[model samples]
Target chain A: MKILVTVAEVATVDDEFEIDGTEIADQYLNADLNEWDDYAIEEAVQLQEGGVADEVVTVTIGPEESEQTIRQALAKGADRAIRVWDESLEGVDLLDVRAKTEILKAVVAEEEPDLILSGVQTGDDSWMATGVSLAESLDFQWSAVVNDLDHDLEDGTASVRRELEGGVEELSEVDLPAVLTIQTGINEPRYASLRGIRQAQRKPLDAKTLDDIGVDAGVVDGSLELTDMYEPESESDATVWEGSAEETAGELAEMLREKGVTA
Target chain B: MTDVLAIADHRRGELRPVSYELATAGRELADETGGDLHLAVISGAVDEFGEKLAREGVDVVHTVADGEEFNHDVYVQAIEQLVDTIDPQYVLVPNSVNGLDYAPAVAGRLDLSIVTDVVDLAVDGDSLIATREMYGGKVETTTELDAGTALATIREGEWPEAEGTADASIEAFDAEIDEDAVGSTVTGFEEVAGGDVDISEADLLVSIGRGIEEEENLDLIRDLVDALDATLSSSRPIVDNGWLPANRQVGQSGKVVTPDVYIAIGISGAVQHVAGMKGSDTIVAINTDPNAPIMDIADYAIHDDLFDVVPALIEEFQ
Candidate 1:
């Protein structure tokens, strides 16, 4: 079996905002790996260790710097890596969920992986829906926030455990050739080994563009447009109450009531 | 006039509050866009559920009674069929687990633009602007959709419940689910047991984080909650350390709450946790660290040890 993991690099906001008292582009621009992507990579590695998959391939879409993140996943023991590089792909909102899903669908069509795992949501775009979107695009069985997965290759079925509200757990079984979005805390990610790090540098990495996947960036353009980006106002006035415990409690309750918080 | 479809999420024969809120939001959007509101219910014996939705300003309720329980494919097919029939200007769903699944699937199949966890929605001329949190709630970004039709999965409690009567006509729609579509089968469900109190539904919540320090100190906070008859919840770290169950965690990964009174005990208010409870009517933070993020959002801040502040609050409430 083969597993595919997709990661995206996102931007962070810095203190220096924009010219109009809004945070500037620099303030709005910090880049990092998808937090949940790490979990996806870790899960893939675990599957390989358990012999559920013979190899794990990591994929990412971003500018050139994103290769560093993919390499990190390689260091974490992904067998190979693929980077879909396009400078214009930066700052694209998740409104193109279908378009991205199509691109992923095309990748799956090419790679023909048995199982695909994704982070439940991305740090940059916490939409938490892309994995399912990709699943539907590929017409594959899928589960979201999956905490556990056990595969039965013979029956082409897999048992999955998902986290639900109120600490509830739901167990379901989906057929193979499925997609799953992994939640955090589902497993402990292993640190990069010295051997894995050295091996990652030598592993095969295929660089591709949207053209390679037969997708035009224009397909996603008309859906959503970034009219402008600005920083949110910091509306924090830290009011400190100083007094005895009883006094503070009385004051707190009164304040809440006055604010119409407590009836 | 276009039609807007709102998917209702129900489990164990009960509808979630977010389902009501999403319906209200959908109705408002439909009104603004000169569209009709259509509610879709998927489950076994969804007639009663469909009727309940009809009262909420929905022009029609579409029911898909194909399964004893939820199957992803069944829901996806039902929603996909609804979208095909309605050609809605907008599709609204709650950003819950079930919604998170089928909403995107429908969007993917229809090749529609989609937004998830949207907190605000408005029409700017012919386009729709959706405001969502970015960087774990550190910033808010608004995405403008130029597409003719857009799909959004709204965060629960973002919109107030609407008041208006509807014809509430219930329509049972055959989803034409196939045996292959129901390939995924639920083996069983294990409900987590502990507090009878549903914190999400609680109007008053007193939540503690790692700031409380020790497991034993939880008793003191419990006393304050008891005195005020307020529900007790906690941050992820508290739950992760086993001081509280995962159900009590108030954060992006846990339960999103908008209580009338949300008291933060020893919680520093990480963005993930704040995103869950910042919508509370009143926020009170008690922490020794004046610089904690929770203090920034608190209506009132007490810079004191929770150990001391809680006991006093319990006594005063009693």
Candidate 2:
């Protein structure tokens, strides 16, 4: 079985950062492999190592600058990589789920992999809908927020544990040619070794445009438009203990005592 | 048609709290659009759920009696047909786990604009303005969908539940579900976090998060937990890192803990984490970042490094 994992290079903002219009300031922003996609890549790589998957390929919808982050996935054991970008995709404040679905669906037509894996959501947008939207667009079976998977796919079925709210898990079986949105903690993502990093440089990393993938630029006109961005007004009226660590600790200790919390 | 159709969510045999909240949101939007509010309760005791959801301001309840549980294919098909039948301008859904499973599919199938995890909503003329968080709640953004008609998933706990029964009409709408399209089957639900200790039962809980840093530092937290005679709990990251078991995880996907005192150390109080433990009597935060989301909700806080403060805090109790 060929497993295709959807990866993204998400932006991380500094704890103390300024929002320059609808975007964060360049100095305070850093790009890295999406934390959730890191797990999805790991799961796909492990399936290949366990002999359930014949090949593990990664697809990313990012700009040219994100190749370094995409190579991180290749370094972690994905066979190759595809980076989708075009001039039409630039300057769009927010790429809604449907636009992404249309773009990924075009790639799916070419790859035609047996299974697809994507992170539950991206760290930046957190739309949490692209994977399932892509599945619907392609008419593929899908399971969301999956935390566990049984690698035995001899019967062309994927058994998964869908993590629900309040500590409940739903065990389900999805037929083959399915899309599974991987949740974190399913497996530990391995760090790229020296050998893997060298190999990644030699691996195939193809950059495709919307035209190259047979997707129309009109799809870039996503329905959603980001109008405003700002730091949420803090509603905090918290009593902050000040001074040195010792003084703050003393103040907190006194409060705990007032609450009758005994040591 | 300017009507608003909202889908209700349920698991096992009971309607989740978000269903009533959806009713409230649907009614609000319906009022804004000068349209009636239509609620759809699909699958799993729909008749009972339909009646239960027929609250004040709800104009109609349409139930599709189908499978015993939530099946995305069933929901997608049912919602598609319902939209065709009612021709509503907006479809509201709960932004819960099950909501994530089907809302996007419905949006893609119908080619409607979709927004998820929205905290607030308003209808302005022909556009829908949605307020949502970005970068894990660090910044808020308002997105406008000028498409006029779209599907949006409202976050749980954002709106109050609709109360007081109404004389709203309840009807059964037949939804043609294709068995061939239903490719997934839910075997059963297993309640996790079953272990020696239940953090929900503890009075004083000391919760740690990513701020704990290295695995070796967990020992310092363990020491503090012992010193205060408080139970040990943690945010999702700590449990995700395998430093603590799922049983000790205090967050939306874990356990809803209402302890007497919740001392959050090194935790950034993500929305999911706050959902689980915000009901605690006393909330304390110890983090170096004063602007961490946890500080906003904390009753008392100490904006200091956990390494410097935790050891000193432990010394106080000892």
lDDT tens readout by residue for model 1, B146-212: 8487889998767876555577778888778778666578888876534655788988898999888
Chain A TM-scores of all predicted models: 0.82, 0.98
Chain B of model 2: TM-score? 0.99
RMSD of 2: 0.8
lDDT of 2 by residue, A107-142 (tens): 899999999999999999999999999998888999
Task: List the lowest-lDDT window of 10 residues for candidate 1 chain A.
Answer: A15-24
Candidate 1 lDDT over residue span A13-66, tens digit each: 553344332233554577776767777888888888887789898777666777
| lDDT, residue A226, candidate 1 | 51
In candidate 2, the residue pairs with backbone N, CA or C atoms under 3 Å apart (3 or more residues apart, or in different chains) clash, namely: none
In model 1, where do residues sit more than 4 Å from their true spots?
A14-24, A27-29, A87-95, A151-154, A220-222, A231-238, A241-263, B163-165, B193-233, B237-248, B251-297, B302-318
DockQ list for all candidates? 0.43, 0.89
Deviation from native of the Cα of residue B290 in model 1, angstroms: 8.2
The CAPRI category of model 2 is: high
